[model samples]
Each structure stands twice: as C-alpha cells, then as structure tokens.
Target: MTDFSGAAFYGLVARLDELIATRPGGADGFSPSARVRTHQNGGYRSAFRGRGMEFDEVRAYQPGDDIRTIDWRVTARTGRTHTKLFQEERERPVLILLDARTFMRFGTRDTFKSVLAAKAAAVLTWVSMEGGDRVGGAVVMPSGIVSHRPQRSRGRILGFVKAMAEATQNGFGAPPPRLEPTLAEAIGRLRQGSRPGTLVFLVSDFHDFDAAAARELNRLSLQCQVTNVFVFDALEAATPRGGHYPVSDGEAISSLNADSAAVRAAYAQRFAARRDAVEALSRQRGMAFIPLQTGDDPAILLHPERMQRTRSGVRGAA
Candidate 1:
C-alpha cells in the first residue's frame, strides 16, 4: 500500500495557495474572490473569517460619550450613565466529515474515490489551518462509528491526515477488518460532533446511502456552511468500448463478451439517471454540491465555472 503521508502530504499543502489564488474574487457573487476576507485572528491572510461580535461588557462612559452612549434613558430612570462594548468575533473551527466507506474504495482513473476525498479534505484542512481558523473533523469508519471529535489546531489536522492514511492502507489495501460506513451514518456522526454554525466539508463518494441522508444534511446546513464533495471514477462513469471483463468472487474469472450497443446504451442511461437523481436530491436540499471527476484536474473542479454552478444550484434549490 502506498503511504500518502510525510513530505508528500505536506507537498499537497503548497497547492492550496494556488487553489486560493484560482478561487473567484469579489465582495459579491459566487466568485472565490468574493469569499476572501481577512483572517479573524487579525492576520492579512485568508478569505473567510469570523464576522460575529464578541461581547466585551458594559463600561461607564467618560467624556467622549458621543451622545450615542449617553444612556439618557438610563440616566432618566437610574440617574447613572453606562455603555455597552464588544469585541470582534474570531474565526471558528471548521469541521470536515470524511466518509471512508467501502463504496468510496473503488476508482478507475486517477485514484480511489477515498484517496481523492482524503486529498480534498487535506486541502481544506490546510486552507483553514493556515488561514488562522481552527480545524478538526470526524472520521466515519465502517459500522457507523466515529473515530474522533471535532477538533481545532494544526497539529490535530495533521494527526487526522495520518490516521486517515493508515486506515486507507489497512482497510482498503490488503485488509484486516474490511468494513465501510454508509453516507447516512457518516452524516449522523458529523451532526453529533459538529458545533452549530461551524463551516463543514462533508467529503465522500456518496454511494450506497439513502435519501434520508440528504434530509439530515439539509437540517445540518441550517446551522453550518455545508459543502459536499462528490467523488467518482471516470471508468465507473463512462464504460469503455472493449471486450468483456471477467468477474469473480470466491470464483474463477471467466471471459464474457462485452454487451451489445443497446445494452450499453441502457446501462449508460441508468447511470445518467442515477447521477441526476443524486444531484437533484442534493440541490433540493439547498446544498453546495461539488462533483469531482478523478480523470480531471483537481484545479478544474475548483474553478470558477464549477464553483458558480454550486452557488446557482444552491440558489435555485432555495
């Protein structure tokens, strides 16, 4: 099993700056630039920062009350003057729910869906962590179990990446306890651990899950900024024009001729319907859906066109 860790993983962080650069810029619209803001911790970096006010406390007004804080009403009642003050809200933690299910274990073009999902998670982690926002997430393993709580800190994010790599190698490569969680299960885990109003990235192939998951996601979105990263393999999506491929499961691999044009067309139609249904369900829930094709460049998936598509989908759904 290839260990996607150490320097190699750190190398991926470098790509984040480029990703941020490619993001649409502006104070409005779905452009990534529009999303840019100062780091909440008072840095000149990052594009998304906290905007809420932190309560400082009431203080007695001195000379320069500006009449706004004169507390005339209070003086009329209590014969004393007081004023309210508050601090700027700092950036909150960003939670990433990584669904490493059996269905995500398959991919045919670039890498396994799980791999791509993890990479995307890593990228987001770096962006958030370096942006001065805390980062943490829950890893949904098979049996619908959660591995950790929603955490904060760069160290915690790195530990998560390491753990995810290990799990992929152990469970997907050659195996011990081969198990995978369903999409609904993963969402449930996330809901349990996430704080309200947290920015969340739910990364998965979104396979073998019921529509109930979509409903739960909608509910979660009411509290958090939810983004869905839908991962898939090119081969699984578009069937190639080739001879029959053998299949086996505790059985011998037998060569069978490829299906006829009509059969292939039927299969393609079925797949198209399935994709449309999934996309539609997500859209109906007013979710930001990012469809990631393994064969395409990751940068392209994060491009303006795709990002705008997500924004429009969410708006239309709303």
Candidate 2:
C-alpha cells in the first residue's frame, strides 16, 4: 500500500494496482504477435495482422464470390463450388494462470516470488488493456482456485487482483489445504474451458510440475497462444553463498549447508533440469519463456529482448 511493492515478501491490493503505471512504453509493449494460428495451412504462416481474420467455414459459392477463395477440392468432390469465408477475430482475451502454492511465498531477496508474479501479472493486464484487450485470470492455490472469467469491467479486474492477493498467502485464513483438484486438475479445467485465440500467460515457480501438467499445456498451446513465466528467487536459481541457511516447509524446519561443492553442483543440476523442461516446452510451442527472479524489474518482465541485454542467462531458474 505504501510503495509499488508492499512488503519485501507480500503483496497488497493497492500495491498491485499501482503496477498499471509501470507498463513499458516501448513499441511492442508486450502485445502478443498479431498472427493467429489455425488448422488451415498446417497451423503455420499467417497473413493477417492486428486482430487478424480466422477461417469461418466453407459454404456454397455465390455468384459474386471471389474465385480466389473457392475451395477446388470441395468443388471437385461435390460438383458444386465452395468458397472460404472468414470472420475477423473480434475479442481475444489475455488470461493469466498464477501459482500460489506455499513455496511461492518464500524468497531471499527484493520480493517474494508470489509478489513478483502478482506484479508481473498486473503489468501484463495493463499492457493488454492498453491494446484494447479483455483481461482476466485464475489463481491456483493449495486450498482451492480463485478464478475470474475474462472481461473488461473494472469491478471484475479488481476481483481478479483480490484473488491473486489472497493467493500469495495461499487462501483465506480459515480453509485447510486440500487436493480436491491439484495443479494438474486446475490446468485441465482451464484447458477444457479456454476459448481458441485466447492469449495465456502462465506465471509459476513450477516446483511441482509433472507429466500431467505438461500434457495439459501441450494441448492448450495448440489452441491458445501461450507465454510461460518461470518465477524464482535467488536461492532457488542458485545455491546460497556457501553458508548454513535455515529453511522450512511449514511442518518441519531444516537447515541447508551449501559449504560442499558437490551439494551445490547437484542443486544446480536439478534446477537446471527443471528450468530446461519449461524452456523446452516453450520452444516446442513457439512461445516466449521468461525467467523472472525476485529482484528483477517487474516492468521488464515481459520484454525478453530488453531483459536479455541486461540479464545474463541463468543455468537454473525456478
């Protein structure tokens, strides 16, 4: 509530709202590529720009129909000419899927991973809004999910922010954690309901990511445009500076010794494998993979080109 960030490790409603002012002023401004992928043309090489046009259906060719749009195969099969008709994509909403598991609340630097994710999501929302797009999101938590349907209403936007703020701390104070639906199930729900042409930004540490989640993402990318934001704290990305550090998983307390080089190497390799899996998925889907650390500037989170100039590649991020 006081600054653009509330506390170093927590997020607040007012603080997240302040991120609207932090949107990048560059030409791109985090707007998704205007190209829309479709089954036609083998799902590649789009010609239209901005909102773009999508193939609607082939129909009986009329007298005034352009010969260029005629489907020759259909004409030969039915002995009647068919014409391809297209509809302009009118509304493509920006959807963000955020992970609010307990681990996201832990950080050793500028802000908590959860707070960083919230801020990044806020920036993305405003950026999309500036381009005249609808914005909405869902927060996946251990207790349950807090979801807001896509819309442009101010009230709905506020509700989305509220859900994320609560998510940073898991959920409302009273609910006990449950597995009614795990992260995989939550993603599956989104996969089933998300409309084609939706631009999805998934923000998560992805510590518990599994094959089921990957399957959902693979299917989801086939329809909607996806951008994966892999959020992490310094400690998670790298071994802490060769010292004894205390850590806990809510139920038990433990101390981590980073004095051994072998331990550090193993930790690095494990994080690297996790990070590579996410990055590979992004590459496979032809989408953006952004590795955001706790101390990185939230405004630059979406601009990988700019982020690259200033940030070095991390062997591990997550």
Report the number of the highest-lDDT candidate.
2
Candidate 1 at 312: error in angstroms? Answer: 23
Residue 69 lDDT in candidate 2: 83
Tell me the deviation in Å of residue 194 in model 2.
0.9
> Per-residue alpha-carbon lDDT of model 2 for 203-281, expressed as tens digits?
8888867898888888888888888899987677568768988776556788888998888888778877888888998
Please list the Cα RMSD from the true structure of every candidate, rounded to 1 decimal place: 9.5, 7.5
Report, for every candidate in turn, its global Cα lDDT versus the true structure.
0.56, 0.69
For model 2, what is the error of residue 94's alpha carbon versus the real structure, in angstroms, after optimal superposition?
1.6
Worst 10 residues of 1 by lDDT: 309-318
Q: For each candidate, what TM-score against the reference?
A: 0.66, 0.75
Model 2 alpha-carbon drift over 4 Å, by segment: 1-30, 34-90, 170-181, 309-318
